[model samples]
Target: MSAPAYSRPAPESNQGVLLARRLLPPVLREWVERLGGELATVCGYQLGLCDDRGKPTGGVGGKLLRPAFTLLCGAATGARPADVVPAGAAIELLHNASLIHDDIMDGDRERRHRPTVWARFGEATAILAGDALIALGFEVLAAQRHAATARSVEVLAKTLRLLARGQELDLRFESEARVSVDECLTMMTGKTGVLLGCACRLGAAHSGAPAEWAVRFERFGVHLGVAFQLADDLLGIWGDPAVTGKPVGADLLARKKSAPVAAALSAGTTGSARIAALYARPGQLTGAEVDQLTELIEEAGGRDWTIAEADRQVSAAWDLIDGLDLDGPARSSLATLTGTLLNRDH
Candidate 1:
C-alpha cells in the first residue's frame, strides 16, 4: 500500500506539531497520541495490522488540528491539557467519522496517502466504522462527566445534521442547472463551519469556561471554518496531485459544484456560459477539457473571489481572536495554527 504522501498542515512533534515547535504542557501530546490507540482498537483494527510492529493500522491519524484546538482551549481556560482529554478525543473522533463518511460518499479511494477505510475494507464495514466513531465520540464525552456534556452532545448532533444538509445540497447542485452564490455559501457554512465552532467552543466548555467565552470561541470557529473550507476548495481545483494526493482538477472532473466553479457560474460573465456548456457536455473529461475548465473558472472571477473571501473570513477570525482573554501561550499557538492553515499549499 505504497500510496502518495499526504500534504495537509500538521504539527510535527510533541513540540507542538512542526519544528520551531515549542511544546506547552508538553504532556498534551501524549494524550493526543493515545487517541490513536483508542481509534485503532476500533476502526484501525478492522482494516489491517498497524504500522511498525503492529502499532494500529490507524495510528495518530491526520493533522489532529481539532483535538489540538480542544486541548489549547482547555489550557487557555486554566485547565491542564490532560483535564480536557475526553473532549479532545471526542472532537477528533467525530471529525474522523465525518471524513470517513465523506470519502465513502464522494468515492474517494485514498486519504492520508492510503486506501480509505471503505476501499480497504468494504463499504458496509466502512459505514459501520463511521457510525461507531460517531457513537463512540458521544460516549467518550459523556464519560468525562463534565457539566457541559449535554450541551456538547446537542452541539455535535446539530453539527452532524448541518453536515448532512450541506452534503445533500452538494449532491443536488451537481444535477441542478443552476445554483446561487448564496446557496453555495450556505452549504459551505453547514458543511465546514459548525464543527470547527464546536471544537473551539468545547475547549472552554469542557473546563466550565464561561458561556460568554464559549460563545466567542464558537464565533471564532465559524470564521476559521469558512476560511478553512474555502482554502480546501481552492486546493481541490488548483492544487497539485503529487502534493494533494488527488488528480489535478479533481473537483472539476467530478462536476460537483465547489466554491470557485460555483462563483464562476454565477458571475454571469461569458465564462459562465462557457462553463455551463462544458459541464452540460457530460461523459468523461479529458486533461485538455480539465485545463480549459480551470481557465474558465478563473476568467469568471471564481479564483479571485474565493481567495478574497477566504481572506475576509480570516480577518473576521482574527478580530474574534483579538477579543478573547486568552493566555499568552494559547494566543501564540492559535496564531501559528491559523497561519499554517492559510499558508498550506495542498
Candidate 2:
C-alpha cells in the first residue's frame, strides 16, 4: 500500500538539527567515554558517534528534537546556548535511552537507517547501554552548580516516571480488546509529551526565566509534543520506509493498536468491522491483508481524524508561543522549528 501523494515543503535546513549537530557531539563523546570499555563502546555505537568496531563515525546522531527544544527555550530566556548545554545533553541522553529500550521491547530491528542496539549488540548489552545512558543523564544534570540544578533533576525524574507509565499502558493496550481515543491520548502524552515538556521547562528554568514564563514554555512544549506523536502515528502507517527508516506497515504488521487503528476500530462503521475482523485473526498478516487493512482504516476516517487533530495541536502550540514575551527572533525560530517538526515525513 503506497501512501497518498502528500508532501510537505522541506525546510531549507532544520534549525534544531543544526543546533544539535553543533552542540551535542563533544558532550556525548566525553560522557560516553566515562562508561569504560565494552559498555562505552556499545553506548557510543547506539548514539551514532562510533561504529560497532568502536571507531568514530562523525555522525550527528538522531533528530535531537528534545535537546533542540531545550536550547531554543533557553535562548528565549536570554541564556547563552553554552549555558544550557548540560540540560540539553541530559535530555538528549534520556531520549536515546528510551529509544534503545523501546526498540528492544518492540523487537524493532532498525532505526535511523541502522540496526538497533538490541539487534546488533544483543539484548543484555542493549539493556546495560540504556541503563548507563540514564545514569549519565542524571550525572550531567547533577554536575550543574546552578540554583535550578536540583529542580531540573526532579523534573527529569518525573518525566522518566511518566515515560515508564506510558510504555506500560502501551503494552497493556496490545492485549485489551478495546482502547478509547482518550486513553490512547493519555498514554501518548506520558510516553512522548512529558519529556518534551520537561525539556522546555528545564531550559527556561535553568536559564533564569521567571517561574511563570517557564510554565508557559512547558505548556507550549506539551502541545508540540502531542502534535509530534500524532505525526509519528501517521508516518507509521503510510510513510515511505526509506524515509522513515523502518519497514512499511511495521505497526500494522505487528498488530499494534496505533492511534489511527484505534480510531478506525472504534468508528463503528462497516469498514471498522472489517478492520476488527482482520485484526482479530490469529497469525501474522500477509502483505495483501495489511494493504487491505490500511485502506479500510483510511476509509473509516482514521487518517482524516488524525491529520485534523495534529493540525489542531500544532495551532494550539503556535498560539502559546505567540503569547510568550520572547524576543522577536527567538519567537520566530520556535514557530519555524515547530512547523519543521509537523511537516516531517519520518
Write down the lDDT of every candidate, Cα atoms only: 0.72, 0.83
Per-residue error (Å), model 2, residue 316? 2.6
Q: Any idea what lDDT model 1 has? A: 0.72
**Candidate 2 per-residue lDDT over residues 172-221, each given as its tens digit:** 99898777778888998888888899888888888777887777777778
Task: Give candidate 2's error at residue 118 in angstroms.
Answer: 2.5
Instruction: Please count the clashing residue pairs in each candidate, in the order shown.
Output: 4, 0
For all predicted structures, in order, the TM-scores are: 0.84, 0.92
Candidate with maximal TM-score: 2
Model 1, runs deviating above 4 Å = 1-9, 13-42, 45-58, 344-346
Clashing pairs in 1: 11-17, 11-18, 12-17, 12-18
